[model samples]
Target: MYVFIVALLAFVLITPAHAQVHVDIGIHLPGPPQLVVVPEVRAVQYAPAAPANIFFYSGQYWAFANGGWHVSTGYNGPWIVVTPQVVPRPLLFVPVNYYRIPPG
Candidate 1:
């Protein structure tokens, strides 16, 4: 009975940690992603909104909006914030364009 009680206590203590839900806060782009060409890098960037600096590169869509780096699988998204360290190397070099909203 003591062993069972200890196991039960352990389960109760550990269960909360496992039950935790990780929430990823991010922005959703309006409308479908449009293709944009970055001539300098010879890479195609997808702009979800014209004049808005959100882009899709490789497999993930990227957004330099809301003062942070955001990424998602689809154009319109439940985006998750990404640190500059994890941002793709190619995206780091994108020259400022008309769509890019400068981060203050």
Candidate 2:
């Protein structure tokens, strides 16, 4: 019985917490920045002129800012923080030089 109770307590304590995290990347573009196709990764286009490391692929705008990845449907965004794993594979493979603000 004690073992069962300990197992139950462990299960309760270890239960994963899900929270919606909104990270304000603070990237406010006056207009859509010029997106140039990345030759190394054909499917992903990067904004070379934008102050932040920004990319466009699969109809979503992605930015690397505030030490994290954020995504939105438009250039000026209500950005949502996302894990690196969730970012598209092709976008992840973009060459270092393409990034306006390369991740350290």
Q: What is the C-alpha RMSD of each candidate to the true structure, in Å?
A: 5.0, 4.5
Candidate 1 lDDT trough over 10 residues, lowest sum: 18-27
Instruction: Give me the candidate number with maximum TM-score.
Output: 2
Query: Lowest summed-lDDT stretch of 10 residues in model 2?
Result: 16-25
Backbone clash pairs for candidate 2 read none
Write model 2 residue lDDT over 1-104, tens digit each, in one string. Answer: 99999999999888776555665678989999999999999999999999999899999999988788898999988888888888889988998899887788
Give lDDT per model, in order: 0.68, 0.88
Which stretches in model 1 have alpha-carbon errors above 4 Å? 1-30, 48-51
Task: List model 1 lDDT by residue over 10-29, tens digit each.
Answer: 98887765332323444444
lDDT for 71 (candidate 1) = 76
TM-score of each: 0.65, 0.78
